[model samples]
Target: MRTPRTAAVLVPLMLLALGCAPQNSSTATDTSASSGANQTPADCAQGKTMKDGVLTVGTDSPAYDPWFSHNDPTNGKGFESAVAYAVAKQLGFDHSQVTWTKVPFNTSYAPGPKHFDFDINQISITPARAKVVDFSDGYYNAAQAVIAVQGSPAADASSLADLKQYKIGAQTGTTSLTAIRDEIQPTSDAVVFKNTNDAKTALANGQVDAIVTDLPTAFYLAAVEIQHGTIVGQFQPSAGQQEQFGMLFEKGNPLVACVNRGLAALKSSGQLAAIEKKWLSDTVDVPVLQ
Candidate 1:
């Protein structure tokens, strides 16, 4: 774990590390609690949330799977949705007491007030982001994977250095794009799209030789989106150091400590693993790009 010279942050490590935890758009660094909780939040009062007696959660509309299922976060079928509820349960709210709100990916951490108690939209806990927003303990550690159509130049690559000649694509303002620049440093400028779907389309149409995304979404695209799609490979970012996703709260939200307690409970109880296994695929078999 990285220590910010100016901050007091407690970070955790995972033995099951692989791939780049390319987030929706930031490098990760923990900025959560430093102490433990009493099984659950000691306070469940409504004042801790955006709405009294309810836990207001925010995510982008059309929330993607396996982060969110059927574009309906209220159903709690996706990985993030399930984790949200699990954290809520630890915080003393049932599914009924939790509510959902729509937020744009960029607006969720733009350095102003937030509209939800916390947001779980694959946002990474970067030191830069932490300056403006508060993050719960990391809920998911992610990996980066690349996808390309069969016979494409990228699909033939065997290492990170081999990818330098291709045009890479990723959603605008996402850490996938950040990963492209920081990891690949391609000979040509990486292509930026409005969203993942657009990048997927560009790759399928041969507009870009390859696309980079979190490993799970890469697997999803290979399964259903790209015709004759193949996983080029997976790579752990920053030389195998783990990057993670955390629940976001408005800066100085006291509820942050409460949420950290809930996350701690999930980790200690093995509930977190169950949720992740149900939603995310194993990365053990994907070859490391370099």
Candidate 2:
């Protein structure tokens, strides 16, 4: 049964999800030219960037593990960090010619002028957000996973149906929360936390039966953060829609095209896949919870 506390959490989550849900309108910027086969490095580097003679990149502060190593996006060690440098290389910028800045996750997509040439903090490409910001071609495809205490009922859940009655939690404003409300649709409203660390704490304290996060982060959390954490399973995006991470830019910025071109080159050369294998290889083999 749903408790008063859970009910309080659900009301806001449902409203936020409804407010941010992707719209069907054709407002997202077109990327056909940027992703075309004939795009060249010189063409991609033609646009004015945030900094002269340098590629200014933005990511969240204290970047987490598996994404940015040791909270340093400048080291070019983690997956996103490495991909950033690779994309810069394809855009004709050398390793030392790129610069890093800190941009919070929520502010990266908000409507406004941006401070970076491109921001890459695993910001998912969504029509709703694209209305306010330009997104380059998808750089990574992602899936959501459920994490629970090792001996809990949620840990034993083999399918979506098996998880519907348990108390679930996820970071507010993330696709993980949307998945809980729209895909899992549990009997009670899922708790929303300020961040992944908060959700992890809730799961550890038994405040929630389980928490949802992206597959790679789930693997990391289950194996390192939470002593008894175990991933129950993973699920594809709801309604056959693929959730993809993209680089973000200011609305109508010409830089989007250039970044898209660089991303295309990375994808064509298999560098993206290689980087994924290096950092997120543990994300494989989790059973699909239908």
Candidate 3:
């Protein structure tokens, strides 16, 4: 019989950060305006310190699983969710002072005013994106990985050249998809799914031989969702391939400075490392956010 562990262990661990972040897109204008019941003058400027002692955040609708469990990103119940609250606490806001809102991932970064304090979906900090939005020191470091069913060709691939023959899939508009197309140089067509779950289903049904995605997410899929599957190997970003996730803000906003400072503090105090081990390392080869 499969003896279940005590509920106490599972229940307590449930409160731990599970590595979730915002998935919506926004522009400077969206975060620059003052709106909502607690909106303030500082919010108009994307100021970190505002009246009402509140910190408002924008996330995506149906936020997606493993990223956000039970649609409660504000409860600090998942990985990025926990990071958001931790950063807010570092900035001196309590649980009651924090808030959450919905937005699309791409729209959050588009050029304009923003309505929330920051967005945290697992965004890769790219040079081009930095021109429009400021990023806090990276809170999570993610690596790209290849996953396949136990008996697939990719499962036996050793060198980059061997990876070329397998049809692979990843979420649309993600670094993982980019890596496979540009770096792995897959000879077979690369597929794009709306989300990871769909991709996992495709992989299971033999629709695709493999899936490339952020390491932790890949591991989560292999271990918990995809039966008869395992990660083949971790991939290193060719010179320009590395992706890091950071807290986002409007360009030139003072709030950026405070968020970075708080992140640095967390890093120095080893709290950040502890959090990383809790959510990321056990599953993937992703390094601590630099």
Candidate 4:
């Protein structure tokens, strides 16, 4: 009964009504499945790791107090140990999935193939070092501290100028030694030792009037390791820029990005601050030397 024009109009209206109708159950399910697939987290796959499904971390042996308690890096008791684990967790590895290897402090940044994914041993980020190795964003800002035996002349010193007359010792290849040579500019050459234990011994035996170490190490040495040891004072960082400690990586390692992401998340979540408070809090009372 309708003309051809009416028929054309009616066909379109019917089609429009059908199109606006509720979706069938199967189509609704398909739409939800597609949306859920897109919402999943991006794959931080284990294939890119050093060993399949395992994260290998490196630190020096006899890892000192506040950094690695009792020389153990696996227990997560020390600041560096705790930080290593937190970063591993961020990379989708559980504590059990991590393995620690003993890598010497000096050897960590050497140009060559590396056996571990990354090393965290208070290694400072410097341009020269960066040429041979990669470094993550700094996890801790470091201050140099002077440690002297109780009743020694160095202990009575109130400023950098006051300490310049005495001999200072520090571990070789450390910022502590650099601080002594450059910041303190002592009358005699800064004594360099193979390790911190040697420097501590030198300070105790009167071979050196004082020793310089990072502030947290100074606290631990005075409080626990060295008999009659006292922290003379902490030095202000050179040039008003705080020295920072960063994790070391193989040159051009792709894993650096992944580890950096982990570090970023830990910092954002307040976990890094919590770890600092737990291990390095003893440095709060130490006086700053001018």
lDDT of 2 by residue, 79-123 (tens): 789989998888888889999998877677889998898888877
lDDT tens digits, residue span 113-169, model 4: 999988888776665677678777667766778889999889999999999999898
Global lDDT of model 1: 0.72
Total backbone clashes of model 4?
0
lDDT of 3 by residue, 1-290 (tens): 00001100011111111012222222111222223324332332243544457788877765543455556787676567777777777777778988887866656666666787788877666655667777666565555667789987778877667778878888775677777787788777789887766788999999998888766566566766789877777665666333567666666666765565556567777777666555444322322211
Per-residue CA lDDT of candidate 1, range 176-241, in tens?
788889998899999988878788899999899999987666766777667888778877677556
List the global CA lDDT of all models.
0.72, 0.73, 0.61, 0.70
- In model 1, where do residues sit more than 4 Å from their true spots? 1-39, 42-46, 281-284
Candidates sorted by TM-score, descending order? 1, 2, 4, 3
Q: Candidate 3 — which residues are off by over 4 angstroms? A: 1-51, 61-71, 240-242, 283-290
The best-first sequence of candidates by lDDT reads 2, 1, 4, 3
The better candidate by TM-score, 2 or 4, is: 2
Measured over all alpha carbons after superposition, the RMSD of each candidate to the real structure, in angstroms, is: 7.3, 8.1, 8.3, 22.4
Between prediction 1 and prediction 4, the one with superior lDDT is 1
Report the number of the highest-lDDT candidate.
2
Clashes of 1: 4
